[model samples]
Target: MNGRPVRVVENLNHALHESMLADSRLYVLGEDIADPYGGAFKATRGLSQANPDRVITTPISENGIVGVAAGLAMAGDAAIVEIMFGDFAGLAFDQLLNFASKSVSMYGRPHPMRLVVRCPSGGSRGYGPTHSQTLLKHFIGIPGLSLFEMSPFHDNRAVLAHMLGLGEPCVFIEDKVLYTRRMAGDGQVDDLFDYGFLGAGDTAPAHVYTEAHGDVDCLIIAPGGMAERALAAMRDLLLRHEISCRLVVPSRLYPVETDALLDAARHAAHVCVVEESTAGGTWGAEVAHVLHERLWGRLRRPVRLVHSADSVIPTAVHLEREILVQADTIVEAVLADLRGEGSPV
Candidate 1:
């Protein structure tokens, strides 16, 4: 886990620590997020020790976490609540939807104390459906709350720092699958809530860093769960035929920022959107739509879709991989786009 080249971004940790330090009014409360035990996922590790008074661990109650966070926010405190999984958050919907997400507009609260609730959601660990639900679509209609899902290890730090700075009620989703994705078959790191930036291990912040090399024809936007497959395909392509490529892994998945993506596509003649979510009414489609609407004719090739079939994740490992996007499939799609073999309209 040490002395190995990794895309480990301690940025999320830095953001949490820095945010807590800068504001004494900030507090974080959730299950298993206290001292000694760290957290259910270690994102809350060491947080309790640094800010003892502010960092309190609540009972095994999602409803209480949401309800209390709402009250804290009403009192003008920046309270960060953690849920173990997105699926488990269903129990707290009454508190979140009826309270936290609605109170500001419903009650017309003056200050609207901010809340940042963090959780680890999605699949890839054979953890089953109880933990595999990517329930972002459910929260989309919950107007007035900020939503953020971090996919890559690189952007976890930057995205987090930005979200914590916004001073809004934010839902931060950290996928469990990314905790140990490899860099070179040697080491790994937790892919917590960094967004739109790169982490060179303990080194200084990196600016959009990637090893994708080739003739450089297409830009692929692969979010959290599918990033590794996309990167692996890029590497394999370069090894096979020396084709230049660029991949934009948005650390912040939901509530996407279109400007940064458009900027990347400015150089990429072709574009593709990859996600583990179903293609039906997903964010990837919106990204492709926006790229066309904003930067018409800038793309030399059609946008390709690499996503899971519109079905629940199957239980079998091989079955799951079959339904999800694959490295080989990503390479094939890129090759099609580069070779002018894909749909141009």
Candidate 2:
């Protein structure tokens, strides 16, 4: 590791390089990912030149790219497909839903389909509607498909390697804004909060950040792109309103692991979920449902959900900000819940 803090994009590039070197069967396929261009976000930088035979640049076809990756996985070779923009993932939904996901069990015996679809997702860069959208909820609950989101707290190297090791189809959501941000280290976040990991064993762990240890007024559960926003809200709430909050960021988004979350929720007076996606049938809703089921009749109020507006993202910078979930949005939601002014669940 370097002495300086590693950027999220650099970490991902390192993971791809290291994983490819370790496993000869690993291949990376995407558009404009070849050397000299190194992809739109530069996450695939130096990959093509280093492994010319393994790293392939294909034509513009989201469906075809994913289809080819799925076919490669079925042939016993691990493949990683990069969807240029998260919005275009919809074009390849049929391939992912029917072919990639079902191949694990549809055959006579359980097959190991080592396929990873890396999507540069989420808004905040003012990429407009077609280019910006956090569509994680749409891919949730797919059988044999594991969902993960990139965060500053978790190492992308481990995430990529772990998914490949699982030998199943995985959707690795990379928040575009996170690419340029420096990763947190030494049990610290923005020099304002101390952080630590919860949950034991090999599974991906939830990262908990707090200004100080002990009981908090509220526990905020956020994933991926919402981590920074959640942390900002936590800081503002504590500094301005004296509302102590504990922020929990999980790397794995799907197949909800509630042990760590339940432990944290039990101690807080209130709980809130923050996400970039719009309301309705969201990952936050799923988490809230699970928490309610497990922590029945013990919470002060219903789990508050803080999310983006339920509308298409606008191209204007100010309009996009209004549509997306900002730090202030989270602070207000938490404050409302504390004041008993939150909407009914």
Candidate 3:
């Protein structure tokens, strides 16, 4: 919490601990969530021990886990239910869609059922088909529930605390691999601070841009792992003399606050949007449309976009990494945008 002591990895752990500490009603229910396993990635590592009754570990049935949580939410208690892995969430569709989402808007009350159905998604760690899946695309159209896509490890600590205090129903998806690979000893557990990759274009694939405003030829927007990779690609482009550029990372993907994206668009001569998801109806494509309609003339050059080609997230580690939108792919897109022939692969 002191000067530059915060790390992304540790920030996540701090969020859960702080949220629970602040609110006793915030109970945790999910398979293997109790100490030891810590719900697979140890996000809930110390919850069971610290809070005791507040952290209730559950059986393997994803449906039962969520169903119980939904009932609790409807009863005016919001519970943070982890869906274990993204793939297994299929078992609890009925509860997630019909019950939890509806209890909020369908009843026409004061937005009751304040619960968060959390999932750790995305493909990485080579866990294969069932485990390695980025299912955010499927939930994009679901109504009655707020969707939150978390990609920033440091901001997560504060964001989680804020979301809990709001008392609204939200599906918070945690990128599964972030547990070990990303989280370390961040100081967020001690205090709340502003952690983002979206101010004045700082972060790229993972770490946001830490620099002050530079003369950027273009602004590239990418979130999750791709955000850092895309920025790397932007740097590579600069190296090759293709162009100078700034990068904007919408660290939070779903329920994306357009204010930040619009600001990024306004700063650069042009902007390119990218993501590790589908092109049509995706968060990236949505951003491009917003720019075209709202900030059209503000940009000297045409709006640019970069995204993952429409394809299944493969199971093979090497192939999967290749299929994902990479830094080189983003650089290629920037090159195309430079020539006035925009190509977002």
Candidate 4:
């Protein structure tokens, strides 16, 4: 695939613009999304100029904005509402978990809650606690909501375009730190993972990075942003410790497509789950539990979960680094487990 040089931010902008052009029912709504400001992260730069009638700038009320989008979806229009920051999702929880989530299921007739909530998530750039939390875990258990995290190596444009047609409520998470980073394909460097479907179904695409034919000692599962560090750690593990590993970066966070994850783990000697959200009752924990429950008898070791500190992320650059998971941190965890220094399953 001859892919062009695309930054994460540009991918988002392209997806929004292209989807708007393709569908007349699609509308973009959020605070400071119009031109001049574009958005808090400029993901909607030229959208307002392209479609003045549909690109709306709303007042600072997450609940009100989401409620309005839900209503529009109920009325048969596809609405993309940006929550500005993941931390602000709390303000709209009632609207999301109550109405948007259960609309289709509650009514016997398919409601098609075609509302896509774009959340700028994850910490980086020292944006402070209130603005920088990875709160995707909070919405993971919602029965009818689909959750997605953009990976640098994946084609976000294609994924977003497809999601626009699914007619389901989706939480599209855009990493703040990834906005500036160029996506991993430029006709030079090969994509770190072989992207494909996990099973016979249309679940989220599963990624397999490392040797294609042989078994991997460790199966590292991580979200998109956290996969960056996980890749680094995997490489370090290979070079330093001679531990062969395969990394699986999932695009879908909620309803985690488990076919490939379980398939990969069946061959691995150990399994590790990494995430950016704070530890304790996180999405990573759920993955760990499932892996253990399914592969407990066949697994060689306990599934380790490496996540961020369970406290408010500090604004101080140095302190923030200490709180968040780094490549070295993941390396240490994998190394310790592989070396038999940690507990077994």
Q: Rate the local accuracy (lDDT) of all candidates.
A: 0.67, 0.89, 0.66, 0.82
| Higher-ranked by lDDT: 1 or 4 | 4
C-alpha positional error of residue 327 in candidate 1 after TM-score superposition, expressed in Å: 2.1
- Candidate 1 deviation (Cα RMSD): 5.4
TM-score of each: 0.78, 0.97, 0.83, 0.93
TM-score of structure candidate 3: 0.83
Model 1, 1-345: lDDT tens per residue?
576544322445566777788789888888888878877777677898899999988888899888888798888777878897878878887877778777667664544648877867777766664667666655654666777766544445456556656555678766677655433221222231112333333221211224322324677787665666776776777678676567676655556667777777787778888766666677777787788888886666657777666677777787777666678878877888778785433
Tens digits of per-residue lDDT for model 3 on 96-130?
A: 78877777777656666767778777775677667
Q: Which structure among the candidates has the greatest TM-score?
A: 2
Model 2, residue pairs in steric clash:
none
**Cα miss at 224, model 1 (Å)?**
3.7
Residue 139 CA displacement from its true place in model 1, Å: 3.2
Best by the lDDT measure: 2
The per-prediction tally of clashing pairs is 14, 0, 14, 1
Alpha-carbon deviation at 81 in model 4, angstroms? 0.9
Query: Counting only residues 3 or more apart in sequence or on different chains, how many pairs clash (N, Cα, C under 3 Å) in candidate 4?
Result: 1
Backbone clashes in model 2: 0
Ranking by TM-score: 2, 4, 3, 1
Candidate 2, which ten residues in sequence have the lowest lDDT sum? 200-209
What's model 4's TM-score? 0.93
